[model samples]
Structure formats: C-alpha cells, structure tokens
Target: MILEIIIEEMSKIVSTIPYLVKYKKHRLTLDDLSTLANDSWLNDQVINMYGELIMESADSKVHFLNSFFHKQLMDKGYEGVKRWTKQVDLFSKRLLLVPVHLEVHWCLVTADFLKKTVILYDSQGIGLQKVARNIVKYLLKEAKEKKQSAFEMGWTVSSNEEIPQQTNENDCGVFILEYSRCLALSEPLHFLQKDTPKIRKRIYKELCDRTLHKKG
Candidate 1:
C-alpha cells in the first residue's frame, strides 16, 4: 500500500518537476516496501527534534502535541491534550498540529481555526477520517470542560493525499515533520518526496541559524 502511494507520487513528481530526475535518480528508483515496521523516536531523533521545535514555536497556548505527546493523549484521552491547552487561551489558538502515530507509521492531524476544520495529512495514502473524527471529539470534550455547551463536530474533516510520500519505510518520520512544517505556516501541500533530502538539511540549518519560519 505504501509503495503504491510512493510510486504514484513519484510519477507525479517526475511529470511536474523534470529536473528532479537528474538531481537524484535514486529517489525515483528505491524499492524497499516490505512489511510495515514501526519506527522509534530514538532512531528518528532528528525528525522528532525538528517536529518538537516547530511545535514549541507554534504558539504559547500549547494547542498541539507532538512525538511523546501522542502516547499521553492516546493513554489519557482528550483530557491529556486539554491539560496543555488550558495553560493559555485555548480559544485563541489558531491551529493545532498533533503528530499521531497509527500503529507503525506516523501521520498528522491539524485542528485548524482559520479554516474551522480538522485536516488529516497522511503520506502513505491511507485516509485518516477516523483520526480526524477523534480530534473533533476531543475539541467537543475540551469545550464541554470549559462549560461551553455550544461546541459541536460541525467543522470540516478531510485528508490531503497530495503531499509528499516516502519511497521506503524510514522516510515516514521525515514526511510527518514536513507535514507539520507546511501546515503550521498555513501553506499549501506543495512538497514532494524529492524535497526530503533538502528538508533534512533544512532542519539542521533552521535549528543552527534560528530561522525556521521563512524560506531562505
């Protein structure tokens, strides 16, 4: 399933960006789509650190949870995410980019206030309707906790299949990081698998130079 998605995205990239085929031929040729294996943050420390840094700089309200926060929320339910949101003005938060780990792979779900929607971004091609529903449920629970009976799940819930994909197993972590980066800035899903190498370097440069919010 993941390989099929990667191939699909690769074909699109080749057609859209012809020069990428010359810069890195290996990107269009890797084929390691075996059994889906779960990766750890320890092995993927750089990816997690980039994700955490972006999440930390996102807002003072702590609207989104990333990396280890997934386990906390999955274990403790909506109250887990709410614990952080309560520290600041929850209603004032414009967006929340929660990195959700589904089984072995990683994906992202955004609680977008500007669009009044919950958008799912999965690079593996699997739609995350159920995951988006859970976030909506969490929002309702959060509203109720604040003594607001008017909260509802009427916000839009959808998935974006157009983002980048990994040609192999290990790159899912990188895809999650890129997903958070793009969505946090409210940008369109313009990145592709070919951008992964550059993104990995960009993370280090951004951290070193302290220039994450803008393109250089």
Candidate 2:
C-alpha cells in the first residue's frame, strides 16, 4: 500500500517539478529541492536539466516509454509499417524513462497485466528510504486508476562484510520494493544508473520517516 501510494504521488510530483523549475527557478522551493542534493551525486544544474527533460516531453509517449523501459528501444525494422512500429517502440521507451529509472525489475504478462520490482543501492549515503517512500505514494495514487497492488516486502541495508570489498560496485543502504499488476511494467526492463532527483527525494523521505520512527 505504501509503495503504491508513493509511486502515484511521485509521478505527480515529478511531472510538476520540471515546469515549476523552468519558469520559477529562482522561486523554486528550497526544501523540495534540498531533498535532491545528496552528496555529490546530484546538483542543482543536474536537477534542473532532469526536470526540464520531464517537463518538455511530459505529454510525449516517447519520453514516457523510455522512462518505463529504462533502456532506449533500438530501431530495428524495415521501412513503412515496420518503421512505424519501431517509432512506436522509441516513443514507448521515452515515456517509460522515469518509471524504468526508478524500477530495477519490471515484467508484463499482457497488454494490461504487469509487475515491477525496484532496488535502490547506496541508499545510506544519500537517503534511499525517502525515495522508496515517495515511490510507494505514487503507486498508491495510481492504483485506483490502474487497479494495481503494491508491497514493500522487505529491505536490506548492506554493510561492507555483506558485500565483499572487491565486489566491483558499492552496495550500502540498499532497499527493495515489489509491485504487481502495473501497466508500466508490461515490457522488457533495463538497468540505468542515471540520477533521478524525483525518485531520490521520494526514497529519502521514506527512509527518513522509517529511521525517525525506529524504537531505538
């Protein structure tokens, strides 16, 4: 339920941030933007560009698909009808960009049946829990329209010993979320390491809440 809510809320939030930042860059809310500034991984300029991309192509299917797939669909079809299909795939890839960036795993059973899973690594350094929380919020909001279900399942914040030093990649403060019956996940999923402020903020908020509420 939390995951679903987060996903839905975040979609709305991210959709709006780009426009707000474009015309109201100077007047943009610091508190809202602060959530994006975690360590050196993300900055104001990066955030602005990120928001711009989302804003400029908000209605475009290409942007939407890219966000969902997490990988650009390669054009591989003959001219005419085949080319038209390829173009559709490209649009899908773009539209799915944000969703895919946030989601690490996604699968589709049919045109409308889908499932998605997400894994946030290096969460401790930045603030992944908040990001996860936001995603849940967004999902929850969308569930009503999409008739979907979401589950936080479990989270694992790994330490050095948990992941060998020579593991090639860092794995600290990692968290996972699983989703079912999602329309966005009805396609091949791909991995992207690009920075997504909207997702980062949502996960950060979730983590902060969990940490603050801990019994200690």
Candidate 3:
C-alpha cells in the first residue's frame, strides 16, 4: 500500500467522525504541539476510523478487533477472548486486524488465519517477540473452540524493518495506525520518521473528512 496514495486521497475526501473523545471539549493550542496524544485520539483515529475503513474496502474477510477487545484478551485470558469472538464470525475472518496498546505504546498485530502466521507491525521497527508469542497463544486457544484445527498455534512471527521509526515516544500510536492501514491493504510501507508532520496532517484531515462518526 502506497502511503502517499492513501494520504493524497484522504486529503481530498470528505469524512465524518462517529467516535467521540474527551479532548473535543478542550481546544488544542500551539502549546500542546509537543504533548503526547491521548488514548481517545489513538482509539478513535487509529482503530475506529482507519481500521474500519480498511475492512470495509476489502473483498476478503477481515476482522477489525478493537483496542478494548485486545485489552480483554491481554489481561483476562482466553475466557475474555471467548466473549469477544462470539460477537463476530471468527472462522470466516482470516485477517485479524488487531491494534495492541501496551504500556503507553502502540503496535499492530495481524493474525493471518489463512497463512498461519503472525505479523507484528511496530513503527519503532523493533521486534516484539514476546508480544507475538502471546498473540499466538491466544489464537491457539481461540482456534480450538472455533474448531480451526488447521491453524497452527505455533506459527512463525515476523515484523518489518523498512517501516518508519519514531524518535519521539508520542508517535508510536500513529505509526501503528499507518502500519495497519498499509498491511491491511497489502501495500509496501514507504513512510519514514521525517514524514511525521505530513503523516499527522494526513490523518488529521482524514479524521475531519473521512470518518463516519466521532469515536473514542
């Protein structure tokens, strides 16, 4: 997926935000430039808007797991995932588009059911081997109940290297969003850290014009 193509198109597209956030009540002055983004922005902008768009445009079955759903699995175990899985058709959705928020950092994890592999997308360009393993464990337990015996619980996990790396801590969430958007569309990531300003603006415009509702 060409990042430029998506950004360019979003610049011209009119969108709405269905998800809501607390920051909407507060005006963001120039003083807030260096401040980190809140969870509302990350949840709404990255997962709700961008993630939903990726799934809606696809012909193949893609499942967009919300950050809340991820929290449940990460903290509450397989029992928590069981409840979330019941809300969607799991076995049919081969592409599990999960955006994981860990210790104030963001990472994208793709459980390719068909490929039987786990792909971690971190803009920091770091290996989250433990996180990958945790995902596989959850998937293994999940697959059992779903009767997906073909899915290997011990799947190979990998992450990208050429993707942009964030020097600043606040942009990790943004990178996860970009990574998910590109990987969901099967596009090669061409973004870099220097493009942060452009990336932020691109997504800001998208939030203003390309969303369905305000979500947080």
Candidate 4:
C-alpha cells in the first residue's frame, strides 16, 4: 500500500497538475514539486518556498532573504535591493539567510549578526568569497542608508567546507535547503549526501503541509 501511494503521487507529479501549494505570498506549482520528486535542480520558486518554511520554523530573531535578492544585488548593486527591507530591519535580525543560485548550482550564505560573521555553505564544496564580500558591503551601505551610520564593525568572511558535500550534481539544491534548515534551528550540519533522498521527501511533505516539521 505504501508503494502504491508513492507511485500514485509520482504519477500525479509527472502529470503536471498545475499549482500544488500556496504558502504566504509564494505559490508553488507542479513543476516545482516535480523537481523535488525527481531529484532535479531546484529553481527559485522551490528555494523561496522552502525558505519561507524555514523562516516560520526559526526563531523570531531570524530573517530570510527572498531567492531573488542575491541575484538582484549582484546585478544592480545595493540600489536594487535597498527597498527590500523598508518595513523590516535586517540589522536587527540575528541570522540572515541568503539563497544563491549561480545559474547552475545552489548555495547558501548566512549572515550571523551576533557573531559578526558571514559564512558560505556550498554543498559542492566550492567557496564563494565574493558573495560574502558583496553581502558585507551591502550591510555597510544598508546601515548608512537606514541607520545613518557606518557599520564599521569588522566581519569575518569564511566558507564552511566541513559540512556535507553533494556527491551528485542534482542534490545541491537539497543540500542548501538542508543547510538553511539546520542553521535556522541551530542544529549541526550533520546530514550526508546519502541523506538527500530522505531530506527531499521530507521537504516535499513539509511544503504540502505548509509547515516545516521539526527535527526529531
């Protein structure tokens, strides 16, 4: 019976049943869920949807940047995303999660305000020094524009290569989401490449339920 249920869901997923879930301001279509089911590269919608779930499950001090925020900043600089935080104060948040899509891969950049550190978590074990630098520069300009002062407090920019690395090309998205999920909950990044399939299913179920299941 469990196998039948799995096959049924997979059939519906491949049939492309239009939109499947709507959480907050984001709506995820069949295409998005299909990516998760087939172990394919996840797109902006899937990343942002899962990100919202992470924000909801995280502490009040946590903040999540929309998936597009990184690309906007990269393409147009601070001016592009300057108005993004008009209502919310990012500096006030303890952790800021930035999901980055580099056309071919997905990675996470987390800003730890309390620790004054910026770390890149890439599943493929690649480093993105420029991403951290640009984010630090954005924070400084944001402070000047919003807080009316220089954010001169030095920040350490580094990459965490010790985290689980993806062995397959398609699991990078799953890995980053797992990275963000673990960080949001203050859990250690201990999951492995072998765990991607299970993690992917859990994420899909969480998305369907419109709530992230806490790690047990």
Candidate 5:
C-alpha cells in the first residue's frame, strides 16, 4: 500500500514539473494530472526510491532533472516520438528515478534528427563531488581504451573552493586528450581537438601491446 501511494504521488509530481518551470505558462491542474494517468507510455513501476525523491523536490535544479529524463528516454528508445504531449508525459515518468541533488536538464539541440543533450549540474553541497570525479575518470579511461576522443566529454563541478577546471593539467584528476578529425571516424570525440600525433601514436602502441600480450 505504501508503494502504491508513492507511485501515485510521484506521477502527480512529475506531471506537474513542466508547469512549474519558469518557461511554462499553464499551471498543472487536476485535469492535467488526470490526463497523465490515462497515458499509456508512462511507466507505473517504481524502480528506484532515490529517483522518486529527486522528482518530487521542488528545489531541485533544472539541469539534473533534465539530464536524468533525457537518459531515460534515450535508453527506452522514445526519442523519436512526434507528439509533444506524449514526450512530456514520458519524460515525467522517466525523471522520477533521479537523485534530487543533481540538477539535470535535457535539450533538443537539433530538431532535424532529434539530437538531444543531457546536462547535469552538481551543487557543491552534497556528496556528489566524488561521484562527478569518478564519472570523469571512467569516461576518460573508456575513451582511451576504445581509441575514442575524450575532449568533448567533460563535466563541471560548482563548489566554494578553487576547484580545478582543467582536467588535463591536474595530476590527481583525469585529463582528456584531444584527437584529430583524421583519427575520429564517427561523431568527433570531445577531446579530439587536444591530442597531438605523438600522443595518439603512444596510445595506439600501448593498446596494441596490451592486446598482443593478452593473446599470448
């Protein structure tokens, strides 16, 4: 019974988010919530309790919420839906799982092919600082192993102290080495612009050596 109430309250909170945003004109009324209950795409199951907290918090920043929704929609393959109302409803349902401290935002950068970007803003207050650092390291390691560009892939943590903004120069943190267009076949990796030929060659050689060693 508790779980059921949580789901019901979550649904109401999510359905009302767009209206609560600064840009939205129409206030989410009882009729609006009823409309959401009737939607088929909205997920009724509550998978994560932390996500439910993020969705319900009125003080939650926009960026974190948006990022969570964008990832959820993309993972579910619902990015190409034609109707705005449906998309909004779907977004609300997916956003219920994000932790409240991370300010998430999603934007449709290009309408022609449905290119969406998810931005996450981490306030310096919570325990998110370490999580952000870990994410950066993981992304960098993955890019290096795959021979992908890591330049464009980066994150920013806002805090009171003088935090290191440049990842490449920091020893304790991760650095993104840029790649050249010639090296990147698909969408340019974020760090493609910062890599030199020497660095690329060294990485390639190390990867090849590791592969050969594994096979041997």
Candidate 6:
C-alpha cells in the first residue's frame, strides 16, 4: 500500500499541466511544477508563487519579496532595486518575507517590523550574518529614501540556529517554504526534516488549489 501511494503521488507530480497555478501576477508553468518532484531543486517561479499564497494567507500582513529581490539588492546595491518598492510601504507591513537564493541554495530572511528584527533562516545551519546585516542596511536606506527619516536602529539581525534543518542538499528549497509558511501564520516550527515529503505534497496541492492549507 505504501508503494502504491508513493507511485500515485509521483504520478500526480508528473501529470501536472502547464500553467497549473497563477498567483500574484506570476504564472507557474509545467517547469515550475516539476520542481516539486522527488529530490528536485525548486525554481524561482515556484518559490514566488508560494510566497503569494503565504501573503494571502497572512491576510496581506506579510509582504513577500520575490526570489530576485535579494539577488538584485546584493548585486547592485539598494539603488538597483529602489524601484521595486516604489509604491509599497514596507514599514507599514507587519512582516517582510525575503527569499534568498545563494547560487545553488535557498534560504529565507524575514524582517519583523514590530519586533525590530531581521532574521536569517537557513536549513544548512550556516550563520549568514552578512545577509542579515545587508537587509538591515537596506531597511535603513529604504527608510531614508522613502520616509525621509531613519529606520529604527539597533534591530536584532542574526541567524536562527534552533530551527529544524535539512539532512540533504535538495530539500533546502522545501525547508525554506515550510519555514516561511510557519512564520507567516504565526505558528510554531514544529515540523521536522522527515515531514518534507508530506510538506512537498501539501505545497503542490496548495498551488493547484490556489489556497494555503490551514492546519487546525
């Protein structure tokens, strides 16, 4: 029965047609859907699409930065991505979810305005203090440029070492998605690395249904 169930799920993952889900002006095609397959590294489109779901589920209180946001900010500095938030007031949001893609790995950085924190969530258990610092610096610059004032100083910027970690290379993307979901919903990070297979299916279904699954 277990083997049959696994096969069934794999079939579903393989059978998804192109443009299966479209959210937040981003269209998820077959290529993106396939990334959810067994052990496959997820692409930018899937991450961004799921981010849209997270924002919706958070009642729009969470502002999700696209997968490219960090890359642009780090590559060209804040000026390169200044227009990214032209009409949006990031400080007005309760949380900012920034998905960080470092070459081949995926991680998350969340800016909590209420708590005055910029945290890095990496499944590899690496301390990315520089990434956190850059985000904090960006927030300061953004405040000066948009609000004509300074952002709150002395914000806590550090990596979260206590969170669940991945045992394999390919699951980092999935781990990032789960971490983002838990944080956005204000839920405890009770999930484990073993739960990733189930989590991946949940994410795929959520994408197909255009809604985030709320656990009761």
lDDT of 1 by residue, 70-186 (tens): 567668887667767656555567777777777788888888765668888887888868988777877787777876554554578898777777776666766777777767665
RMSDs, each prediction? 12.0, 18.1, 7.9, 3.0, 22.6, 3.2
Of 3 and 4, the candidate ranking higher by TM-score? 4
C-alpha RMSD between model 6 and the true structure: 3.2
TM-scores, one per candidate: 0.68, 0.25, 0.72, 0.90, 0.21, 0.89
lDDT of 2 at 53: 37
- Prediction 2 TM-score vs. true: 0.25
Top candidate on lDDT is: 6
Instruction: Output the worst ten-in-a-row residue range by lDDT, candidate 5.
Output: 105-114
Q: What is the lDDT of candidate 1?
A: 0.61
Q: How high is the CA lDDT of each candidate model? A: 0.61, 0.29, 0.63, 0.82, 0.25, 0.85
Worst 10 residues of 3 by lDDT: 27-36
For candidate 4, what is the total of clashing residue pairs?
0
Query: Whole-model lDDT, candidate 6?
Result: 0.85
Candidate 4 wrong stretches, greater than 4 Å: 1-18, 148-150
Clash count for candidate 3 is 16
Clashing pairs in 6: none
Of 2 and 6, the candidate ranking higher by lDDT? 6
Our tally of clashes for model 2 stands at 56
Candidate 3 lDDT (Cα, whole model)?
0.63
